[model samples]
Target: MERWARELTARLPALAPDRYAVARPPAALAHRAGHAWEQLVLPAQAAARGARAILCPANLAPLASRRTVVVLHDVAPLREPGWYSDLYVRWQRAVLPRIAARARLVVTPSAFSRDEVVELLGVPADRVAVVPGGVDERFTPAAAAGPARAALGLTERPYVLTVASRTARKNLGVLDLAARRLAARGVDLVAAGGDRPQFRTEADTAGILTLGHVDDALLPGLYAGAAAFVLPSLYEGFGLTALEALAAGVPVVAGARGALPEVCGDAAQLVDPTDPEAVAAALERALDDPAPWRAAGPSQAAPLTWDATARAMDALLAEIVA
Candidate 1:
């Protein structure tokens, strides 16, 4: 959400400096009190600025502002209730409907999410727009893989990589099983993302190197160093990591579920995330002979750009405010 906001706001000034300005909450609001600040303080600030319309880039928006544009990434609370606590899900269930109802427009990262919002959240389809996520320009094929491998103390041995949060919905357990299978065949697995309590015990298992929360600056090289990038997730709003891997010229093996297939298109090898054997087989194919997939990756990723995404948002905002 922060990345989207930063990139979008950076481009907005170039597109329409006179019409749009980035409004940030005062530093007095602590990071822990972000929800209260969004719900209570943000709208008041915008009103004081005499803003015609406010664009809330993150999922949560002020329900009191009727002219606000809300970006609802997904209806995850309703779709995968088990992934979140009861209190959190209940809060989202209560407030999200009101936010959607009062907002002038709802923006989503993918068509899959737009449909999910319309169907699950009872939002009108006409009010939703699919802007799609974009890959950073830094994630290019030219990134040097050697420095990243050396920094991580990785050998020249081939490896499969996956970047995602260590959550149940990310299906890292299935990736672990596949990793164990691949380990016997002389291939290693590297999983990079923030650690979660639910996956702490699983992270200790051998044959899989869990580099918890790698720096964003090193990600392009990390992607380039991998023989293949895997995403064994049960669900995703827009599988942005898969696109990043493609942009880095890495072959991808992604789960067939959620928006992965839609985002990956024919660039990635799709597998059933729950099936460890299928995941292993796809990884094996990418490692054994990556020529075809490597050739296809950059071409597949070429069209997904932050500038394009920002332009679409700029157009939508213009239309709403006009």
Candidate 2:
């Protein structure tokens, strides 16, 4: 979400200096307080700025605002029961439907998510736009792997990588079986990303090497060095890391479900996320024959840039204000 907000807002303003402005809450007031600010303070601030239309980059938008364009990535939180905190589930249940009904436009990252919005939120098809996230230029085939490999103590070893928070919906445990299966072959299944407060999943991580939270600077090297990248996420609005891996010229094996297949197109080896054996087989295929995937990566990722996302967003913003 932060990437979505930061990347789009970073580019949108430069397009029309006088037209776009961003409103932010203090960094300290991050989660709940930030939500409060967006509900109570942001609308008034938008009014003060004489904003014609406010773009709420994240899922939620202030109901008080008359003209609002909201970007709802997915409805996974609302779909699954007992996965998230009761407070969060209730809040989403109440707010998302309202946003769907009221917001002038609701942007999503993929056609799969657009369909989810139309079905789950009951929003009309015309109001939803698919503006997928982009891979930064830094992630490339030539990125130096030594520093990142040494940092993570992964030097001289082949590893399959996945970057995701240990949330229930991420299906983090699915890869543990695959990790153990691959261990015999001298390949490690490594995971980056830390835990979040909103989730309560007790996913056992006995097989995978958990790197608490990797530095952003090391990500490119990490992706470029990996033998293959796998995301066993049950639902993904947009598989950014998978795309990043593709951009970095690594083979990808992602969960066949959700937006991953759409994002990966034919570049990645997609398998059933729930079946560990299937995931393992796909990873082996990727590791064994990486040439095709490596060759296909850049071409697949070339068109999905931040500039393209911003251009699509610019069109949407223009439509809303005009």
Candidate 3:
């Protein structure tokens, strides 16, 4: 959402008729227990002072906004309640429907998510607008691939890549098992993201290189050099990383769960993220069938761009304020 905020602020300066302001509540508080109450109070107070409408990227927000638009990323917690802890699951079940009812409008990242929201939250279809995300032009086919390979010492063996945080829904445990199965066959698995300790212990480092983070300038080269990109996330609103990989001309293998299947469409190899064997088999197939997948790469992510996403958002802001 930072990317969206920055891009929007850049696209339409605050000096325009509608002032663009992005505020981050006390982060330390928001992550802690009882912090939502303490952290939200200020934004609730600020909502009245020229903050005509508030846009929430996540389902929960300060309930005291003047005119609100809540962007429900997914209905995962509501649909698959078991996937989350009891407190979190209970929180969403209690709060989301209330937000949906009270918000002036709702926004979601993909059509799949929109449908799920309607089904799970009982919001009408017209209430949700599907404003898909976009890719950075930096992650293009023309990006330098060899430099990242050399820097990471991956110049020799072919490596598959995935970029996901250490969240449970990212399904890194399944990828770990798949890497173990592929290791006996001498295939390399390189991942970028996850906690430092988790990557150290969980990832298959035999031929794997796990960097917690890299400079933005080097990220495109990393994407461009990969044999393929894998997104084994069990749930996603819109798999932006998958789109970035496709934009970088890297063939994608993502889980069919949530909006990932819709985002990847036919450009990716969809697998059951819970099945390690399936993930391993899909990885093997993606590694072997290079010609067909690579041929479909350039056009796969051609439709979405930040410029388009910004325009859609701009139009939404105009409508909301009008």
Once fitted onto the true fold, the runs of candidate 3 whose alpha carbons sit more than 4 angstroms away are 12-19, 26-48, 146-155, 176-186, 195-209, 213-217
Candidates in order have lDDT scores of: 0.85, 0.88, 0.74
The backbone clash count of each candidate, in order, is: 0, 0, 0
Candidate 1, after superposition: displacement of residue 257 in Å? 0.8
What does candidate 3's lDDT look like per residue over 1-322, in tens digits? Answer: 5455556556654335455666555555535443465236646655557677776655566665537777777778777665667786777788888888778788888998899889988989998899988887898878997787777666556678888765567777787666776666666677776453211234333434567666557778888888888888888989888988888888788999989888788988899888878887888887778667776766878888877776787688778888
On a 0 to 100 scale, what is the lDDT of residue 195 in model 2?
84
Displacement of residue 303 (Cα, Å) in model 1 is 1.1
**Model 1: lDDT of residue 18:** 94
For each candidate in turn, the TM-score is 0.94, 0.96, 0.83
True-structure RMSD, every candidate:
2.0, 1.3, 3.8
lDDT of candidate model 1 versus the reference: 0.85
lDDT of 2 by residue, 1-322 (tens): 7788888778898987777988889888988899899989998888888888989888889987758999998898777857788888888898899987889888999999999999988999998988888988999999999999989888587988999888888888878777887798898888988888877665757778889799999999999999999998888888898999999999998899899999999988888999989988888888889999999988899999888888889988887788
Best by TM-score: 2
